[model samples]
Target: MDGEPRTNPDVPRVDDVETWTHSGLQAFLQALFFVLIVRPFVLLFLGLRIRDRGRIPAGRRPFILIANHSSHLDTACLLNLFPIRRLRHLRPVAAADYFERNPFVSKLTRTLFHILPIDRTARRKDASGQTGADPRQRMLAALQAGQSLILFPEGTRGNANEVTRFRSGIAWLAQAMPEVPIVPIYLANLGRALPKGHFVPIPLFVEVRVGEPLLPRGDREEIRAALESAVKKLKDTP
Candidate 1:
């Protein structure tokens, strides 16, 4: 009962853990890249001051991690918070067009970040104009398989210190997976360190505040508002 996935029967499950599980060599490579490269870059180079870390789900349980998107570094910073062992189950939802643009970038992102690519336009169209599988179903399948997700409800990166209007995609996911927890994270100064369209990261101290998991109550608008308010509250935290 402990290891079994708890989800509605309507949600499809990838029967094989192999879908999410990596080979021994692949696992070792991922850990090595994160530990030797990413961890040091996020922690030592950029500097991190984390709060409410205990609020992050202890183990590999299914949850949606919502954060304000201001910089590309936001994902790296959040990914660095978890231990190496949990990295495999932690998938960051990224734009398919950007992350999967080229074969090289796609492979690198898949190896380093294990990103869950989503179509920003929601068209689900490929380069050949063929309709691809629904990104929402991909998310549902991942959740059904006991994986946590990192989602930037703001959708795209914006001005530093400004949290834009949250997209309703999160609300849709929340409605579908009522049993799953939705965690809010407020990132401070990351946008300044690595703002949009910037390459080299500035050496600025970053603050990561984790808030209580949100209760997906009311309609989609109300649920979206609640999640937005939670992240904003974290921004105001001293």
Candidate 2:
């Protein structure tokens, strides 16, 4: 069967804008699509470079993978970086409004990658316009269930691959689950390859730089700056 809703009967689907429940068929299709279609296309055309991948500790089921968000390629490149042994376990946290805006992208995203859709802005500011604190419980739940996540701490797309100030969620995740290491990834030239508001993608070389896994060594703001620094440093590196 195709993908269907799999969740506890009580936690409303609306709240699950950040949950990782997907279809077995879609996962299979995604592997086929990425391996046969996306992989060769990326490798032969826009090359991928993963710097110091060993820094990412092995055998960690539910660590956080945070990176800059310049284009959609940020997540796509990450899915390729993982080895076949751990590919199925990586979950890319996508925005609900963008990825699930329509039927086709929704289906593809859900099926191909085990995605956890999160409300980027709208739900956070409801009718009362009140802001809550660190509303990423679904992510925590996913981690509890042993699912590694590829998250964009920037929360939205940025310009020219510049690393933006991160949201507090990354810091929250690290603090909440100190055992899980937060991997900082630097994706170069993704904006040039397939940037925002572009349909036909250019065949440009892209690099994925993985840094040493970090914990919330400092407070939220300090940790956020450290993560950003890690990514920015890659811009000057080979």
Q: Which candidate is the best by lDDT?
A: 1
**Global lDDT scores for all candidate models:** 0.81, 0.73
Candidate 1 least-lDDT 10 residues:
3-12
Q: Tell me the lDDT of candidate 2.
A: 0.73
Report the number of clashing residue pairs per model.
Answer: 0, 2
Give candidate 1's error at residue 200 in angstroms: 0.9
Model 1 misplaced regions, further than 4 Å = 1-21, 124-130
Off by over 4 Å in 2: 1-20, 126-135
TM values, all candidates: 0.87, 0.84
Give the Cα error of residue 98 in candidate 1, in Å: 0.2
Write model 2 residue lDDT over 1-238, tens digit each, in one string.
Answer: 0133223242224344444454566567777878887788778777777778777768856788888888877777888877654666787988876787777787677777767766665434643454321337767777877888889888888886477787878777777788888888788888888878987788888888888787767787787778778777876676
Give the CA lDDT, 0 to 100, for residue 188 in model 2. 85
Tens digits of lDDT, candidate 1, 26-65: 6678899988988898889888989989998886578999
State how far residue 21 of model 2 sits from its true place (Å): 3.3
